[model samples]
Target: MQAFDLVSKNISQIIPIPIYVGVFVVLLFQVFPRIFIARQRSIGQSTANRPGKDSDTPNGIYDRKPSLSSLVTPDPTFSWRDNPQQIPREIKPGKYFLTMNVRKLDFNDYIIFDKRYLSEYRERQAIISNVGSARIFVAEANDAALDLCEETLMVTVDFLVTRYPSMFHRTERGVLCVDAGEEYDLVTRPWVRHPLETMCLLSGDDCILMRCCNDGVLRVAAVGLVYSLDIDWTSFVGKDLASIHRDARIPFYESAIQKSVDRYFLKLQPDKPVARANWLTQIGPELRNEKFPDEYFRHVSTIPGNTITPETVVDDLYFRVERQAMRKLPSMRGVVFKFHLYATNIWDLELEEGVPRRFAEHIRGLPESVLRQKHCLEYVDCILKVMDLMAERQEKNTTNFHN
Candidate 1:
């Protein structure tokens, strides 16, 4: 005991008691945890570096490669043209005033690829080439806009490959369209085009992305229109819902459904998708990239649109219907709107029971401002006359068949 006390007194003299105490605390509190952490890290590295092996492979484990996932059979594509029931029946136009005709939709039917692909593609390419991509593909330049654009492209590409696997298959580097003989790298786009533009070129539907801004108003962030039917794409980018309504010159939007539209978008859930139908009458049957839309839309610059009459309208009119869908993004306060266009001549309207009569009655009831807004005023009277006659013939045929 005397010897131990003598050694302790010597140590205390060499180093102050406080210094020894501080060294003890430093070792106890800081060094131990660090030592323990380093031990754990070493163990983790060894485990991770260990090669993965199959239960059956005791010897060949070091040389084994990772097993690939099982191949999946693609679901049968819906042949919308062959299946009349699958094809949406022409919407019987109803009411005169503007209204949100949106209804819930199944994701499987969000965008359609049907018989019209080639013609639509041809027209889209031509429009982009002739009018400049600015008119067809316009977008805002910002982080929010770009993120949404990229997300939209990813979502659409995944859908296309899954929905039409035979036509679009996944490659190591990208998605390949067997029909087009073109491969698109989803991760990389052409230097001249935006990601959304590349996606628009590949998709059958035109895409428009809208984001809810700091003001809590939803505004268009990006847009790619195959053909600008009623509204121009350039004017819509970065504009709020109200601005878009005004720009489209939609009649009674503010008084009728502006607030409702805003509320609908704000409350829209990612799971719930909605679609609406829109119609317009073109001067000719799906007029190709017009040689002179720069000069005239009415075909002859001298004639003017109002000169069209029932007798003159028979061969000169085309009915266009747009299947527009809007849905919310799961990760962002934004929505993706898409348009799928379908067109038929006036004569085809008579094929469906009561469609001719219903369409004509619907037209006659439309308010003048709404008619002008839709660009239907030019051929409204002409359509009414032709459809009335067609309706009579349909009625007469039904009567005779029953007898």
Candidate 2:
């Protein structure tokens, strides 16, 4: 034992304690970061492998991106017009108020291509030309707008080609192959400088990219408005959630649901997308006009209980429903708010079973304050009377057919 101790003492003396300390310091500086980085990599891999929780999902953008390889092929025969999405059954009789009513969104259902595609795209181009891209789309100056734009385009084209292989393809470099015509490449166009505009022109859809600010509230980091988009794009740019919702004047959003929604946006996971729907009964089929933004929306502010009677309301009623979906852009650290609006003249759908009666009942159930916020309280009676008439005619037709 003394011999072993003597040998160890000799070795220690030969190395010198200060030299040992120097070598240890070198290793700490050089090796620890790499080890720490490796540990981080391992954690990320494990997190991706397992399901993501709000608390655990890494904020790194590159962790998970939607790619063609990951896409779920849509039903070959799915027709957006014929196969209208089922109106979510979240509204309850006598219990109607503002609600998120969001559901898990399948990637395949992210963008809806309908009979209105060509017309909508034409309208989008006109809007772009008239309003200019700056009016509709905005993004953070320092963030990965380029990457987000490109990645978004890639996923979008992948989805379109996969969903409607006959209409769109990756054969050339475009999203379209509608005819024996030139196929659009699966890439951005050289002529368009603005990435978001290119996305709007190609996809012809409405989407806004939002990121949480330092204050912990989501704000409009980007926009790509081409359709009859929901948000008044110019109004909410750079505005936080509280201010945006307040400006939006959505009933109960500020008081009842702001915190919940703020947390929802803060914690939204990249892999999991959610969806919701909003319905409005308006006096006209024209829900929006891009050239005169928000003009149509505000015109219907007060119908005056006296101005809207059953006779006047029946001819002018239209129902507009916007199917909305929200998903996190992992790469951009943003949440995308997407909407597809479907408007049908109530005169056309009044006969559809349960359409008028259900909507009327839901509207009637709204508290007076809610109705006032909705701009319909003064005219609620007229609206209900028209609804009853439609419901009666529908029931009578059914009874006649049965008899």
Candidate 3:
């Protein structure tokens, strides 16, 4: 059969042409339209639910908001200096005992302005205001120490002027002066030439100025020292704390004290001020070079009788306490260690209630190593004798009180 004729005959027999046409029309109108509509709805839902550019979508799969801290700026005026906390002001008799519990220090208790502030300020101003007297107290500043001296002096002046305006005044000539009956020009005065000299003018405390060099160690850059009990300012100016104490007959630089001192200086902050107290027996109250030379430690092995005798230890000896404080200057980026020398006669301890007994305990409890380190071993016998007499007196008083 012919191919075209054969296909035509089969189509005619299989189905009517109308049925095929109807099925095609139904699919085009109903099925195709439904599929198109369903696809459009699905797209509309997806668009409605999708997150926008400003949506709170988290970084990963969760949603998170920014922290409040990230949105706020810190207050610049709030610092450790704003509100300094209180420290124990009373000089407790047994506070420094060797066997006593280690006292905890608060960060705010570093700089203390106690009852002695006015008296000390008056004494300092008196020395600096007098031309002849000021020359004797202040050492000539070296080149290396000049910048530090100036910066330290400025900071001290600013602090005193701002904190105690009644005590310090600014003259019409732009000079900062201390009011001591007559105004003492701290800045332009002939005797008060340098910044360190100004510090001497403001406070009786001996200022040992230090700066951290490239080696990360603190060096005594300058000193405005009037009353150094033993150490010489000339010899101590250029040396690090460790090197300065290296020649001590006792192993101070090698001991734990050095480590503690270095760490304290390193971690000290501008706002926090810290003070420590150290007591030593001095021959007299003279501020000059009353002790032997720096090299005396290298030559002398034993403590001389004249240095620490029963009579000298009891009668002549002065109980010297260094109320030392270290503070960081924000502008200078250096530390200022101020030592206020407070001296009382050994016999005066008897008058202060409980001081004699507590002092005796402190001295007795000190280790042999410590005594040697402090160069107190040679005078240990004399010190013990004095302490024993005080103890006996204390016991006799206690017995009499009970009756």
Q: For all candidates, what are the clash counts?
A: 0, 6, 3
Q: 1-403, model 2: which lDDT tens digit per residue?
A: 9999999999998888899899899889989989999999998887556543442223354466555346667566655455443544345566766766677888776776666666666676677787667767766665454455555656566567777666565664455546334444444445245666656665655777776566666777677766554445666567777887687577788778888888887777656778887766556655353312123334443545445344565466556677788877655356778776666665666747877777778887888767765555656676777778888898899899999
Look at candidate 1 and tell me the lDDT of residue 216.
89
Query: TM-scores across all candidates?
Result: 0.73, 0.72, 0.60
Q: Give a tens-digit lDDT track for model 3, residues 157-258.
A: 545545445555667643444334445444353433565655665654578878777778888777776655333446766688778767554443455477
Deviation in Å, model 1, residue 340 alpha carbon: 1.1
Give lDDT for model 2.
0.65
True lDDT of residue 338, candidate 3: 80
Model 1 earns a TM-score of: 0.73
Please give the lDDT score for candidate 1.
Answer: 0.69
Per-residue CA lDDT of candidate 1, range 170-252, in tens? 89866886766777775453334666666766786777889988888899998877665534666678888888888778889
lDDT of each: 0.69, 0.65, 0.57
Q: Is candidate 1 or candidate 3 better by lDDT?
A: 1
Count residue pairs with overlapping backbones in model 2.
6
Best candidate per lDDT, number? 1
